[model samples]
Target: MKTIATASMGVTVALSLVGTAPAFAVGGSFHCDRPPIMEVMEQVDGSSALQSIVNQYLVRWEARNATEQCQAYADGRPYDISCMNGRRDWPAILASVPKDYFGRSNESLAAAVRDEKRKGNGLREAMAYCRSVGAIK
Candidate 1:
């Protein structure tokens, strides 16, 4: 009787797993032939050193924002969508910093970037600078 009951439970569990399998397959895909963001940044003339600085800035931004972004996404707020989409522009912000600023410690640079972002100057001003400097097209 115990052996028969065990076999019955195994069959029930297998059926349940099969029924729910499609739920695990949910996610969209993005297809892009262009190089990744960092690679594109590095390919810009005079941007190799700037790319390193941008990487440092991105590491700090991700550390600071990842949790909040994840929570926002979990809550189904559109805010996370905008936030995730905007991340591709961050490298331009780091590149916008005056070259002199690169001499500062990473902490200082990160702080300055955060401050500028808080003041609403980071993305707009940075992208403008990048365009002017030819760091981005």
Candidate 2:
């Protein structure tokens, strides 16, 4: 009976793991559009670089409102969308998109990468700056 119980417990644990989403799936592709927000998180500062990128994207999206921002994400170019939490008064867009969408803008992320080099700091430092400015977390 003890052996049977242990086997059941193991099976339960395995099932739990299988039920959850894969970490990579949550992160999605590493395109400029879907930049990795975790890579730039500075826990000490309580800032978010990804949030900054989202804000910039909203600005441009509001101006165009034609999936232009999404296209920019696809094209892998520097584009601004910053506009107060990246919604630009369009809360519905924020609600409809996935939670990961906020941090996946290419323009701010590319800027972060370039800033990393210009400041002569490594990835961690650059990311910290991005977070401090509320760019990505």
Q: In TM-score terms, which candidate is top?
A: 1
lDDT (10s digit) by residue, model 1, range 20-131: 1111101211112331333324333332333344434443343334334334434555323122333455555466556665556545555554554344413334333333
Q: What is the TM-score of each candidate against the true structure?
A: 0.32, 0.22
Per-candidate total of colliding backbone pairs: 0, 19
Write down the worst ten-residue block by lDDT for model 2.
Answer: 22-31
TM-score: model 1 vs. ground truth: 0.32
| Cα RMSD for predicted model 2 | 19.3
Model 1 bad stretches (over 4 Å): 1-47, 74-76, 79-87, 95-137
Q: Write the per-residue lDDT of candidate 2 for residues 12-77, one digit (tens) a residue.
A: 334222312211111131123322222222111221333333333332333243234334534565
Model 2 / residue 76 / CA error / Å: 36
Backbone clashes in model 1, listed as residue pairs? none
